[model samples]
Target chain A: MARWGMVIDLDKCTACGACMAACREENNIPASGPELAGDGRSIFWMDMLTITEGEYPNIKKRMLPRPCFQCENPPCTKVCPVGATYKNEDGLVAQIYARCIGCRYCVNGCPYNAKYFNWYPPRFRDEEKRYLNPDVSVRPKGVVEKCSFCAHRLVRVREKAAAENREIADGDFTTACQDTCPAKAIAFGDLDNPYSEVSRLAHSVRAFTLLEDLGTRPKVFYLTEGEKHGRFKI
Target chain B: MDDSKYNELDEELLLRPILKTGKWFYISCAILFSIAMFAVWVWYHQWSTGLGVTGMNRPVFWGIYITNFVFFIGISHAGTLISAILRLCQAEWRRAITRAAEVITVLVLFFGVFNIIVDLGRPDRALNVLKHGQFRSPLLWDVTSISIYLTASSTYLLLPLIPDIALLRERKTRLRWLYRLLSFGWTGTDKQKHRLEKAISVMAILVIPIAISVHTVVSWVFGMTVQPMWHSTIFGPYFVVGAIYSGMAALLVAMALIRKLYHLERYIKEIHFNNLGKLLLVFTLLWFYFTFTEYLTTFYGSEPTHMTVFYSKLTGHFAPEFWVMVLCCFLIPLAVLVRKKTRTAAGCVVASIAITIGMWLERFTIVVPTLVNPRLPYPRGIYHPTWVEWSITAGCFAFFILLYMAFTKIFPIVSIWEIKEGRESSVSETADRVKTYLPT
Candidate 1:
């Protein structure tokens, strides 16, 4: 019923990578270790895409953080042989790690390259183990994982709302990445609520979803970085 | 009645492989068994550890296992579809070769399915596909179609083997009990013959579509994905053609070996090779046509996302594999098979080996290029298969050959009864049928 969504404004964003760090800390994703990382096996839930535009001396660089699109018409969910990945009524794409057969079909199906697989059993760095969020699951070896839009926070908020006989408010379900953004560049709330700041920002002309022409209709919208910043403006 | 005179020689040749065991059989089996065992151990290590034991990583989540899955399934197309098509067309030559082809279909399919299981990150939870199957997935479509194909092809195989088993039963082979149980009390009665013929025909018709659909669904596993180069309309027919091409090559390889080892040359014949070579040539041309159109369309479109993958295969990191595939699947095949002079059994086998390797490369190029160059900006993923992946792949091939060898020993690779029927009935029936095609 919530139709949860996110909007990231490029102008304010500094690409600090605090969001990525916070996501793993909250979601319990592991550091795949240097050996595995060299094999291109780095595990990330929230990640960044670095785009280098123009020639060497004239180069312009942009770093855009990427989260699961939580697509309205998800290519990933469509191809899961088991119902391990599905979009809930709240319009959030959810992965059931216990049910995942680790076929990686969903990973291949994602156009954004947003998903990561647990090549080894979930490993936590010594300091990471201390901060492992109890509410989040430590995914087993071999299952695919991605940013869940911080759905666990929503569950806790929902339970609290239910106990108080009140409906969940838009800001009550913000993702860890949105909360961690020092620039306040990330906004998350119920997209269905027209009055919500996230929804208002999503309506901005600069806001666009990745690979939108493919019609995935991602709930995650990115506000274009530079238009008046220079040329590369759509 | 005079058929017994000719059948005696045919029986001696075809049945010798079954009646007598060879020293090479033990030696080869020993080699194959060890390779398969090593692969098993590697798979065990992967299970205890993780898929990281293989060379697979992000982006390249699939590798040789998926390639083998597609390749073996393509190889499987060699038998049932070809045999069924030949049988339906009333090709008399099919009588000697159909059983061998059908055996490949039945046995090779298991490994095709096995490759999928081996590729899984959570193979232990593979049953989840069955428990919570969503038909919406192309993978579920693959499961359903391949399972039907395996069942239908194996039954189709068993249906035609009853009369052969009866022959072996009468001969009192060492596996008399097996022959008896499998023969279904087949007697040479007119009623039994008529029923068997009808059943075989029904299965022949049924198996063709099932075979075609299996490969089509296999292609859809990629086609349904919106990945660059993979989302194409032609993938269904393209995959089916490739499957048949590689399958025919595998059949030739197997037939050549069967002929050499068991000395089935007289029965398998130069003429059979000649006909199959011509067929292989046609497929080679078809394969080239599909590959040409597939790439040419992408190149022409110049769609940036697709061009990245397209250029990767043509002139980039995958160029070596891509060009070699063209050489193997098209150029070499066209050279060896096109000229009638060099289309001998040996020539066919050489071309077949090329085509098999080429087809495998084709599968790898198709799977990897798109994944490596992700749609979003990231470092292009690189894949180098670990020893575990290579060992398992080698094991599957050895395992396939080993099973095929065991099948040859247990059953007459060439159908005895079909050969007899061809000698007795097909000769007269062809004359009568050809008469109808001509002016009286």
Candidate 2:
């Protein structure tokens, strides 16, 4: 059995927001125009958060990249009246858009605010429509969507591995964010395999999960910058 | 009392709305119906466009629709629960008020259910909650409990109306068939009365828990979340108290309005308002107690995210609304009802109106502030309800009034037989009971 996980090294992250862009492009997330975005209607499955600490010249800035933590005990799944969102056996938090009634209960339940609602019909330029990913279904208005860890890639990888009659390779499947990360900050793989890079990185001393005390047991891990680095004092 | 005089009073008071069609009634109905139709058109626009027509956004996904849902549901608590409790206690004053209260419960609950549908992004898929519902979710609990409460409340409302329906049927009014179908040949025999009394008693006992559970479950829709201010052990009882508080205020307002408009002052007397005002005062204190405890614990514990929401409500963006709520729900009611001089019928009316507004604000405060300041360090999301949302809200109120108006025309707003029963039997029965209690 595979337990997919991710490890994002905050020290390596540049806050370039490419991961957000890549996730949106890969997942077919809607584009809310500037007017709607100003109202906080923008959809970003992977988001970049910057925290500023201290005043004046003593200030330091820290950047945090956030995606769905895919908690082992997902609060969002627990409150979904229609069972539209659920944690799969392979440890992926999956959202069935067709089943979603768009009550927005799951959107509110998510502690990390990873979920996004399609407030309007997804907008695509005439040229951009041709570039829409065929593998991924374009979600209609009135459903929730979030980062799926590029779960479709996993499906393709699994099919290839099965046809080749061999075990799935760690390097074979990577999330779009992981693939597009300029600094190679995000690592994705089966956490159950100790030999996997994600498992090794997750075991590092500085490795932590966002809101760890929430007891969501998020599959996503973060290796924080060491104390000698410009980690914010606060 | 002379039977002829009593009969004349009944004929004039109870039958007036049915027998007579005044110009004011037609005008009010036309106005209310027009506003309600306009709201329906707005909803149609939303259905054609999307939820984006409203002010809801990423983090603050729930807006005024949810606020109205909670508010109307809380208003529903004013009906069957209060009426049932009063009936169980054999309070004589309840005879003039229970029908109005129960009607409010039924009509308001319909609006409450509609608000949920209006809030849904895909209202067409709403039945999926039943078709593929997961029982584990608090939302499912809400669906289950609310449906049960609605059924129980409607049945409870109908049970007492049988005798009245029979009365209307006998009179051969305009809607005679409707009354006959509803009356079920209720002949007012001893057996029939005994059955009706038994049913009302059983329902009175059954309805309290269902009514309590309905609001408690509604609270859980927020409380069960890990959101800062919403996750509280006190939410169940707190919401129940709030519901009853708001419900009492709604009932008083309705009673006062009916009294003035229908010339029901002789029946819905000053004493009813005074007693209901005192009850409102008790709930006001209770609501304040819960609010104090809820906020005090959050303030003292000072969990970073929780404190953000707490401070936001206390001294930040939500402060004005929060303070206004306190003033309307607590200060005004406390000042008015605590003093004998100001606890007049008019005074109670003022307090009731204040509490109704206060309770609506309370629901808004509870829902929005927490979402605006999420656990994550996102910028505070601003929620300004769009005109569409406002129109829908206005429409809901207009619809409720229209339904209530139609109901008053069809049936006696006060339970005629119950009042007659009370007048004829209770005086002698109370004397016997008082004698039995003396030196026993």
Candidate 3:
């Protein structure tokens, strides 16, 4: 089984939101509406948070693209009363949409605010629904949803790999965010494979997980910009 | 044993059925219950819609729903702890008060559990908690412990009432059907009396710890969390003390009301209220001491997270509520209860009302303040329950009162058998004691 992971290189990345847009479209997430901002109804699977540090005129902006960390010891998974959410055999914390009781215990228990509750029955344009990937299940109201790392794409990769009589490749199961990154800043692959790009990037000196002190052991890593980008802000 | 004594007992038994048929009894019940039913209809709207009906939002995920949960649960501790502890301590005045307190426990426990469903985004999914419950979670512990306590409390309430049921069965022929069905063949034989005594003894002994665990577990639901204000070690004992404090106040309210409404002045006298008021005063001081220590340590530590919540309660948004709660729960009650003049029935009722309100504010302070001030740099949370939340909360209170009303109709609110036994046993004993102590 693959130990799925991602490494985002801050130095190589521009502050473009192409990855965010791609992730939303690929996952059929709702576009940001005025009423939904900070309401837990906005369905941004890939969120861009801008952190500014330093005094007025010397301000710096660092864009952090956050997805669910898919922690090895996921607090959200641990607190889910219904076994609706759990860590799979491959270490990915998966959500069983049908099984979720909509307790929101997982949402309250998650420190990162990675999970989002479906406050309303999902609303989408007719044309947009037509474009949605048939493989992913649309969530109902009250259930929580989050970035699944395009796990449906991985299932497709597995099927294709089986049919072709070959093992899955690193690029074969790339998430929508990684596939559409203009700067090639995001690397997604098996971290256990020594030769995989994700493993190589993950072991970089600047690679770190957010709130590492929390002991969540997040599979997602962020690579800070070098001395030239000045300082890591916020 | 004599004709005059029999006439008095007969008069005592007649009072319950008469009250059940009082002029506005059913009319008032209908009006109050229809309002409760309307509230239930509103709850259905909440069930269909999402939790958006409630004013809960990001960061302040819990509001009045959770606060009411804690508050109702706090009031429930009044029953088993006070009654059982007093019984064990051999406080004879407890005979009249125990049933009142125990009934509150069962009703409040039911109300408290319902409040959780009201808080849920999906009330239908409540079974999922039991089906896939995590034993390690404090919530699951709460489910387990509270259920056990409820069962024990209900049994304790019923066991002592068996003899009374038998009395109604034998003495009152008109109410023979109910007495016959409910009395469980309670023949006042020596062996039966022995078994009843043994059962009551077992329950009184066992219930005290279970009662204590219920509130301790409740406190742990918040204390186990890493939230700034909630994660205190003192929470367990602090909650237990608060429970007992408020429980005594509830007892006073019930006692005074029952005394007036049922004319149970002989059973529940001024001495009973005086004893209860004294206990309430002790808890008032203890609760104040705990609050002082709890806040003083946090203030001295000056940790940003703890101090934020502490100052917020002391002099911020919650300051008015906090100070008012202190005055109502402790200062005024303490002043009134200590003075001989103010320790009367009306005075205790006022003090009890004050304590009840103060305890509710305490629950709100505990639940909301910590939630509003999370440790992170994200926006601080604020909560104000929407109409849906308010209606359901009102429905819960109405349901509690309705249950108590139903209980009074079914059983003698004054514990007729206990009063008989007290009258029989005490008169002889008091004369002997008085004679023994004279001119000593």
Candidate 4:
């Protein structure tokens, strides 16, 4: 019965890219070799986008960290021919790799371009293989993959809470990105629970979702960097 | 009917290809088969190595594979729309080109379906679309419509062929058993003729809407998506119109080739091409109208995301291909076809060839430009198709022609019996109808 969500506070964030690195480590996303990376085949569950505003002397750099928005009205899932991708009751958009025909219809339908396709079989260096996260399944070539909000960690936390006969607390289940953010900018919790930090931050006057006019109803909210920093247009 | 006249019709038109095996036929077959085999090898390489062999990436997930899928499927409309509608309207010239058009429909539909499989990342898992297909998806609608169209069009092609098969069986050709098996025990009895006519008429009527639905559903595969340029109310009609336009052009090209190669100049005359040229002119004008309205609305509305795609085609990397498409699909066809003096068989052939290429580029322009310019700016994706994609595409075309050539050898490319029927009975009926139209 939980409507899980994430709220990212832009004011506190530094463009350190720790979240992206942590996500790569936590998920089994393969490293596209330098050649493929230059070709824009890099697999990133968490991505950092840099925007440059204004002319010469007045220029400012703003870093935006993007993960899947996990929309309640997901356009990607709607276009998938097979039921390869679907939104769970917990508000996480999940992909079933085995069922994916790799038609890439979902990839085309997605407006945010959050989805990534495995063009080649995932490869990890011999040493990196030992460090691969055991909780995540390595995706095969030809299927699509994307951020899952560390739903595996949420499952572990839920099991622990069930064993203790206690409900999951606000801070119990956090995404790898939320856990690794050095500035403590990312907050993840059940948005339906008013007491949760994500819920409270989501209600802030400055909070907004990307492409809100598209009516995707994204659960990932962004709290604007206060009046001093210029408002993010997109 | 005069016995010598009937014998001459059968000997000159229907039996010549079946009875004789030219060296050129074998040579062409060898070349086409080898090219097709090379394409197969390229596909196997892609299957083993993964889709990374192609030039597709994040935003450009679909490229030429999807383009070919749409292009071939659009070409399929040639047979069903032209043959079926012409049959329904009782156009006498249709007797020469109907079988050719119908054959193109079935063979091109096969390759159209094949292209989708080649595009899939997990072709092995393609059956999952049947097993766990979501009806909400436009792709499911495509599966349903295409399957129906295939079945209906194939049946439409087969129905008229039965009487011809009976004729071939009576001739006792080298493949006597094959003709006997296919003829389905037709004796040319009045009852059998009536039954065959009923079946053909029913299928002819049934196939038109199914053909229309197939392209409309294909368009919805893009239209139903929330992607910037693809999500439009006009896509369904636009795609259907484009399909018919391209299909007409393909039919013209096929007719011209069959007329020349098979020496059926007497059966398929200048008048047939001239009539079809006029039809092509109508489609050319209509295609232009649709293209004009589609872009004009996109430009006038000036939605930012739509504008990105609009400008990408109008002035960006796709501009050259886009203008070429305009010239091929519209201006050249218009210039050649609108003028009565230039609307010769050769002119029609040239115009049709241009439209076929133009329509293919039109599909490419529709699919690639939208994806390269994503709604959210990460980077503008570039898609440069590799040899693997190119080979597979080449293979698909070769396979289509090979199948068609093989079909021509085994069966009559033009419906001989229908031509006979039109010659014997339609003249009297047509004269009577014409008399009614004339002032007393």
Relative to the real complex, the DockQ score for model 3 comes to 0.37
Each candidate's interface RMSD (Å, one decimal) is: 1.6, 1.3, 2.6, 1.0
Stretches > 4 Å off in candidate 3: A12-15, A38-43, A50-62, A226-234, B1-14, B17-20, B171-176, B426-440
CA lDDT of B347 in candidate 4?
Answer: 97
Provide the clashing-pair count of each candidate structure: 0, 0, 0, 0
**Which lDDT tens digits does candidate 2 get at residues B1-440?**
57423455875687787778789999999999999999999999998888999999978999999999999999999999999999998887799999999999999998998999999888999999989999999989989999999999999999999998998888857989899999989999999999999999999999999999999989999999888999998899999999999999988888888899888887899999888988888998999999999999998998888988988898999999999999999999999999988988899989999999999999999999999987766777888999999999999999998999899999889888888887778877778878988995
Measured against the native two-chain assembly using Cα atoms, what DockQ does each of the candidate structures obtain, in the order listed? Answer: 0.77, 0.77, 0.37, 0.83
Deviating ranges (above 4 Å) for candidate 4: A56-58, A226-234, B1-7, B436-440
- What level of docking quality does candidate 1 show? medium
Predicted candidate 1 versus true structure: per-residue lDDT over B227-326, tens digit per residue = 9999999999999999999998999999999988998877889999999999999999899999999999999999999999998998999999999988
- Which scores higher on DockQ, 2 or 4? 4
Give the range of the ten consecutive residues with the poorest summed lDDT in model 4 chain A. Answer: A225-234
- Residues A152-181, candidate 2, lDDT per residue (tens digit)? 898999999999999898888899999999
Model 3 chain B weakest lDDT span, ten residues long? B3-12
What lDDT would each prediction earn against the true structure? 0.90, 0.89, 0.80, 0.90
Candidates sorted on DockQ, descending:
4, 1, 2, 3
Docking class of 2: medium
lDDT of 4 by residue, A1-234 (tens): 889999988888887999999999999887778988977789989998667777989998777899999999999999888989998767789999889999999888888899999888998988889999999989999999999999889889999999999999999999999999999999999999999889999998879888888889999988875663335533
**Residue B368 CA displacement from its true place in model 1, Å:** 0.7
DockQ of 1: 0.77
